[model samples]
Target: MVFFKYPEQIRRVMYTTNTIEAIHRQFHKLTKTKVRFSKQNNLLKLLYVGIKNASTKWTMPFPNWNLAVSQLAICFEELLDATLDL
Candidate 1:
């Protein structure tokens, strides 16, 4: 039997996803006043800038991603193994 002993790691991964999502929501809140960006290019420019600024935050690896991905792959192995599971 495969044993996944790292509950904290799983929690950390979940927490990070939540935290990043919260930050994204904050960005939306902060930009809610940009209602005048009616043109597609103008909105795209704001999105581009937001993404560029957020990209600067990747200073380190998400600690459990390597193991978490492996565990997840194993959990969904049958789905992955099937040729047309999607």
Candidate 2:
């Protein structure tokens, strides 16, 4: 049960639901600011658009793909390649 994150911008990844809650805060903001929409569908549209925009600027995967895959194969060899058919 270990996790690692890059040192670029976001530091340690906490167990708490902080990131999701932060996004939910944006939804709350939309409901408050954009009052009196003609119908419920418009509210849904606003929330969906806001989340889509936020996700676009998210940080990318860790750059060293090969190294990570190799380490994982070694660590979980029993489950990944457990049999020898050939």
Candidate 3:
């Protein structure tokens, strides 16, 4: 399969959809308690604050990230080269 072509480290990162789902769940939780917003900007501000707080918790980098990047570069040499050129 196409997925099997990548290294194990890359595969692990690829299967981390739960992290995204957790962020969405957190966003829902943050908005759920607030029934009404005075203006559209107020709702936006709340979401912006939520994002900022969530980002702070993401300080940890992926394990073996350099190895994953190396594997990805090998798998998509042309693509990475093109991106780096721009």
Indicate which candidate wins on TM-score: 3
Q: Report the number of the highest-lDDT candidate.
A: 3
| TM-score for candidate 3, residues paired by index | 0.75
Over 11-65, each residue of candidate 2 has an lDDT whose tens digit, in order, gives 2233332678878887887787665899989888988998997678565655554
lDDT scores in order: 0.66, 0.61, 0.82
After TM-score superposition, what is the CA distance of residue 14 in candidate 3 from its true location, in Å?
1.5
Global lDDT for candidate 2? 0.61
In candidate 2, the residue pairs with backbone N, CA or C atoms under 3 Å apart (3 or more residues apart, or in different chains) clash, namely: none
Candidate 3 ranges beyond 4 A from true positions = 1-5, 17-19, 82-86
User: How far out, in Å, is residue 54 in model 2?
Assistant: 1.0
**Which runs of model 1 end up more than 4 angstroms from their true locations?**
1-12, 18-23, 79-86
- Each candidate structure's TM-score, on Cα atoms with residue i matched to residue i, is 0.54, 0.47, 0.75
**Residue 53 lDDT (model 2):** 77
Whichever of 1 and 3 has more lDDT, that candidate is 3
Worst 10 residues of 2 by lDDT: 8-17
**RMSD (CA, Å), each prediction:** 6.3, 7.1, 2.8
Kindly give the number of clashing pairs for every candidate.
0, 0, 0
State the lDDT at 71 in candidate 1. 59
